[model samples]
Target: MRPQQVIDGDFTYWLGDMYALLGEKETALRWLRRTDEISNHNYPWFERDKNWNNLRSDSEYQRILADFQRHWERYREEFGDG
Candidate 1:
């Protein structure tokens, strides 16, 4: 099932979050990577999202988040939202 209103590429992020909530770290990360490739979201809420708390200690997750943070920061600087 899916929500009635969703922006492009959020489906992948939802899949990743679902997997993370289920304790499927690897699968979650895989979907997240795909989301990153597909949407490259600004990620204003990503770092603080509790959905990925399970991955907080994972190195790969950290790396991905770091990359997202860099990109998101740039996005904010360019767009003036943040």
Candidate 2:
């Protein structure tokens, strides 16, 4: 069976984090994107998240990080939460 049902946004985010911790880069990113889509989380802590340190030098990971930055910028502009 799947690791968990991912019954909510928090659970989804946790799975993404777990995958990152396991060094499953592709799976981790897939789950992370799912979490972001479900919760629209800004993921401002991504750069500081130790779980993703292994991905820091990865070009794909950097792209994803840029995407997160852009997403947060848009979110802030829309909600004035920056």
lDDT values for all models: 0.78, 0.73
Give the Å error, residue 73, model 1.
Answer: 1.2
Query: Residue by residue across 1-78, what tens digits does model 1's lDDT show?
Result: 332233446787888899999999988888777767766564767788899998999999988888788888887789
Best by lDDT: 1
Give a tens-digit lDDT track for model 2, residues 1-82.
Answer: 1424454756766777898889888888777666666654656887678888887898877877787788788888898974
Looking at model 2, residue 77 earns an lDDT score of 87
Badly placed stretches (over 4 Å) of model 1 are: 1-8
Number of clashes in model 2?
0
Segments in model 2 whose C-alpha atoms lie over 4 Å from true places? 1-7
